[model samples]
Target: MRESPIDDFWVRARAAVPTLPAAVPEAWAFGATATDADALLSLVLDGTKTGTASSLHDCEADGDALPEPGQLSVILDGSDLPRAVIMTTAVEIVPFDQVSAEHAYSEGEGDRTLGAWRAIHESFWREYSQDPRGFSADMPIVCERF
Candidate 1:
């Protein structure tokens, strides 16, 4: 038997900013860099705040479990002196429990809908069909800067 490779991916968005106050947790600084999705991925894997020297790739992924978007940001602080701020929102792509990857794909690339419910449904369903029991097409996830 062979284990099929699971492509579990999520996109995190962040607003670009310079420095965030040290009092604020690095996890919440995601809003400072919400457009750059890669930063969030780094945060997910390695969340230790390195104070200008830290990077997310440094973290260890012990298992294949996924990170909770809101929860994920809170667990880590990025490397920055006083911490360079990161405005981030995350989208995680995991192996479908029922829906196959062939069916789901991201809908909004350049188009912005101002976060209407219809827009949210379109985004999730456009990339992938609804999970019904888990993530549904009716409700949408809204990300913001911390």
Candidate 2:
């Protein structure tokens, strides 16, 4: 059987970090599209992006477990190649409209303002969200700080 890139990446990452678990964590990219993934990943690699948000409805629908503090994740690029490993420092569930400006700033997108964050996320979710629930002002958002 051919070894996946993620498996190979995990081997290298564990070698460097040394403290990572023997089992690899989940690997994922940032956004719906390759372009979006690359752009968002750039922010993360540059240390400008420390936070991210996801639709709780989507997670539930997909049967994915909620993120928790101390969880490790492998970040993939637009091409689905692992680039970096991140540790979840915090996770909060909040209404979409209630997401804090501090969290918005940590996302490091657009003008780094709540308004920008809302606009960007709203549009992205509306267009790309897998869940039919889509975008809503009061929708539950999983805000994660890593």
TM-score of 1: 0.23
lDDT of each: 0.29, 0.95
TM-score, every prediction: 0.23, 0.96
* Backbone clash count for every predicted candidate, in the order shown: 39, 0
Question: Number of clashes in model 2?
Answer: 0
Candidate 2 local lDDT, 1-146, one digit each (tens): 88799999999988988988999899999989889889999999999999999999989888999999999999999999999999999999999999999999999999999999999999988998879888899999999999
C-alpha lDDT (0 to 100) for residue 144 of candidate 2: 99
Where does candidate 1 stray beyond 4 Å? 1-24, 28-36, 39-109, 114-132, 143-146
Model 1: lowest-lDDT 10 consecutive positions: 4-13
Model 2 CA lDDT for position 64: 91
Q: Residue 61 in model 1: shift from native, Å?
A: 18
